[model samples]
Target chain A: MSNTTALPISALHERVEAIFRKAGLNAIQSGALARVITAGERDACKSHGIYRIEGTLRTVKAGKVKPDAVPELVLQEGSAIVRVNAKCGFANPAFELGVPALADRARACGLAALVINDCTHFSALWPEVEALTEQGLAGLVMCPSYSTVAPTGGNKPLLGTNPIAFGWPRMGKSPYVFDFATSVAARGEIELHRRAGKPLPEGWAIDADGNPTTDPEAALAGAMLPFGGHKGSAIGTMVELLAGIMIGDLTSPEVLEYLGTTTLAPPHGELILAFSPQAFSAGRPGDPFARAETLFEQIAGQGARLPSQRRYAARARSEAEGIVLTAAEIEQLDRLLALGLDAVS
Target chain B: MSNTTALPISALHERVEAIFRKAGLNAIQSGALARVITAGERDACKSHGIYRIEGTLRTVKAGKVKPDAVPELVLQEGSAIVRVNAKCGFANPAFELGVPALADRARACGLAALVINDCTHFSALWPEVEALTEQGLAGLVMCPSYSTVAPTGGNKPLLGTNPIAFGWPRMGKSPYVFDFATSVAARGEIELHRRAGKPLPEGWAIDADGNPTTDPEAALAGAMLPFGGHKGSAIGTMVELLAGIMIGDLTSPEVLEYLGTTTLAPPHGELILAFSPQAFSAGRPGDPFARAETLFEQIAGQGARLPSQRRYAARARSEAEGIVLTAAEIEQLDRLLALGLDAVS
Candidate 1:
């Protein structure tokens, strides 16, 4: 077991921002990156939080990801569709430009869709979706990555554990957010278990031969299973075509074949949709936000819990008591701090 | 075992059309209904074929579904966003108005989305999607219906076995079409088994208490399972929100609780999205369809067959020879044919 320590949210954000600054990211990029990373930690999404810092930093160091790059609007028409040439690393600029643009279009068209190709990995899609809900729009987002999974009953990895997220604005509470990968388990989870020397749960992964296995090491060397079997496989496959092929990027299988080839580019594609409530019920007198609140209250009254309830609860607790960090993670931070000092030498 | 007979596609279509006409449908509506039904039969999708005729006719007779209603575009903005009232049923007018509207919008916005609410049941969605591909647009469609499925690990049905479909254009061949329900097994499949006096395959359904069962009757009395278990369940749940709740319609629980209420309305919603190749690659500069065809061919050449290959092959055979109907189905049709004579009396 690792020891735990508490740090104020603001303090953690400042520290992260400082590190990014030292790593040569511009002020705006560092600020945005800090905010995204802190939000993930507060939401208890450890897999997408600071755990990704090292990998991101390495990409930056290799000049493979540009922190200062701004995304360009490739196409736009009415309030229905928009396309972005995502020149920056995926997370910050995408949130800065894509979400607001799509929401604006939705406001005008009553429905809007944005497709962004050539974007790097965007962390914890829920934040981006929630941002749309803040603008009183419903959001649905899907991102397809390079293949990290095999089709159900197949021996070779042929798709990514592509993630899909949707957010619906509710009345007085946070929007109902649902975000998950199509795989039985995510690659991060397998890595976490491997690092901790723990076994994986059944149905989470398969070996190279397509036989189930609980060994994390074997799982890393093989493929993650699609959650729910064939249906999950189908969903993941659909995401590949919708977000990848539709965007004119590499399909899932092509991404797999190009994996680990430094000469090959990162897999990329994202689709975001926003909907305005006015389109469906034009003259309903009630405020949509109020109606949303009433509906959530009714469901809660019936003891039917909404998804994202726990995440919000976790955020509240973290705000009150400060964020908790494992001793191992803190040690890694200390190592990074030392690296900062060594860099000056 | 039941005897079966082969009938030419045109004959089957005509017979089905006659039944609809006798049931009070106008010429265009009856023709549309007949074509979709016959197409299902030709593709061996018995569940969505003639088997649905009786239920559909009852809906029309009860005045719950409009027979001659034509969908009207209530809103359109820059060809990127559209709202179709679906004044009649979902399949016919939606195909007639929704696809063309979406394609035009996609051309303007690079992407387009259409929402069709207040529509009646639409049979297999693949054909409608294929229509979009024929217009040189990528199609993604989803429809959520009244509750016919229980949540994973839950007893009460809280969602429809919602289906999703996608179509991608290829050169010199038919478009790649994929359509499937989010359920482990469609309700129609279980109903078919019950009619044939056969046990259902395991893992397809659960009883009222949420325990697995293979009895078709029990499965019907219970709820169908989502495909791939939790992952499929998640997708189905997303569809319920995206196509149903987001459209401001009745949710699954609400529909179930108010099923027999005088104010009850159809609990179904659909979302159709279109993406222009120009949006991603600035049109077919080097033959986009040809490129897509080559990509798929190369993949298949490497033994990676695309989904829906077998279904398309079967459809071709049926068209070339004739559609086959079981003895029970033929008897049902004959009984319906006799109804026309009785109506004249």
Candidate 2:
């Protein structure tokens, strides 16, 4: 036996939505969360897909996150900056409500930013920025989550992995999406290595004493190192300034108290910035799209491909057939299914 | 002999200004170019300091750059997005006129962007971003210069080193700045390595055949690699879109035809984004400054230094004790000084 099973993409979304609803999320919350998870799976981000649902549900059960809390619009300046008060709930719902408006503002004003506060970020940041790119806008998003990283020179861990995601709308293809945590390897990747009994590549993490280590467990016990050394660390700090301090929200270090040891519902902040190319253009002959197409040709002529190009390829390939979950993964999902509806219990 | 000479900071600026004026630039153009070059030296950016003067002067002399052209404000949306047509001239002059207004607009509107098209960005990006931070605003500036580096997996050079610079306004202190070309090392660094006959670290560049090489000469003959592989490549692409494509200008490769074999005045675009934290803040009890102070403490506590911390340190040291320039650099500047004034000639 292959020891794997394939499920339809629609079934996956419905299952995720049902699970969120069963855990008592409101319709908007469940749908928003489900869409992101399904999209993540379709994009081949197994780290954030079906694998993350249990921990997300645990946040609802622990009473740390109010699953049905509707986000609030706290403040705005002109049409360029909008601040969303997430009311200590899932971030997807806030993005769902705020991003389209932010894109509209960007369309009108040339640029706009949506600063989200008091939100529990449940997964990767790609979906957040992709929303804007889908509407022919360029988008950049950053969020500072729980601290698990050390700054460049020190042994003490005082920063989060701090993922940043960006998307650029193309002429007719999928938007060029790029998303990554500032760390050399994500915490989940390291955890996977440990679970698989494999060692990590050098420079990924450190031991409890903060010396470099390839041992995933020891590195996890210590801290993740920022990618590209000081440059990545600086970007991480910038992320904190934008998503945390500028948004009047908790920075990675400041949010430590709110983080549960096992189940997490840390009320982090996310900052989304959108830009309209047409607004920046002077109505010139060689507009943005024409220039982008030239760049794409040049990039493709060389062996190097665009970021998230692989994701699009995987997505198309998987959608044609389906993705197969390993036996262990199936077991994890089955366990959640066995729990049934909390309302029934 | 030490082969180095120490000159007063004022002398450096005056010398640079004299060279520009001697080459037929107007007063504003001369002063703006001089200020940026002097600042590059004071800030210890040796690559762009006196070394870049001749190439800049050549642009003015060759008629590639309009030495006296005034950049026109072509378009603006609301108060947030300002697009400047650089009139086929030097960018510093345009930034000199546009940045303060852009900062004021950002202060009023919460976020603002200045998009410049048809200009030669001839100096370090730090000065441009620091302009906003000096006004107590956060700033990010990106520009696409001549193409030299390739995408991550490709050997063909399709993108510029593509510098990205950022600055954060600090309370009662020099603004924290971070600037780096999104490459394993800047092309300038590679040239320096070649001049010094030094070997490169791994993953820096690929030789003509697209195989990785540590030899500085081979690496220079080939294409430079992106910093942190694909993540940095994506950032490079994003910069091209924002600074080149979105601004309705030529992408890096598209501008390459105008570049001379030795001298460069490739007209490119620059994108400047500014954010006013005060505008985003709700005036809560714990203001943004307090959070920044707390963040500084955590950063210091963890023994991690902020980006551009070294530059500020360098500037302070250089200001106290005059910076020493190499004999070669002095010779280059002295050659221009020997030419005297164009009107006199």
Clashes of each: 10, 0
Top-TM-score candidate index? 2
- For each candidate, what is the lDDT? 0.71, 0.82
Against the true structure, what is model 1's DockQ?
A: 0.37
Q: Give lDDT: candidate 2, residue A345.
A: 15
lDDT of 1: 0.71
The residue-by-residue lDDT of candidate 1 on B1-345, one tens digit each, is: 349888999999999998887877777678878888898898887767897787677666656677777777755434355677766464566556666667777787667777776677657888778888888888888877667777665676766778888888875677877788888887667988999999998899988667789999888878788887655776676676666666655555555564442122344557787877656555212444555665555435534457667778879989888998888888888888768424321
Over 4 Å off, model 2: A1-6, A74-77, A260-265, A322-345, B1-7, B75-79, B260-262, B283-285, B322-334, B340-345
Summarize candidate 1's per-residue lDDT along A191-219 as a digit string, tens digits. Answer: 88999999999889988766789999898
TM-score of each: 0.89, 0.94
What RMSD, rounded to one decimal, does every model reach?
3.9, 2.8
* Candidate achieving the largest DockQ: 2
For candidate 2, lDDT tens digit of each residue in B126-219? 9988888888899999998777788988997778888899888887888878899888898877888889899988898989888999998999
Worst 10 residues of 1 chain B by lDDT: B258-267
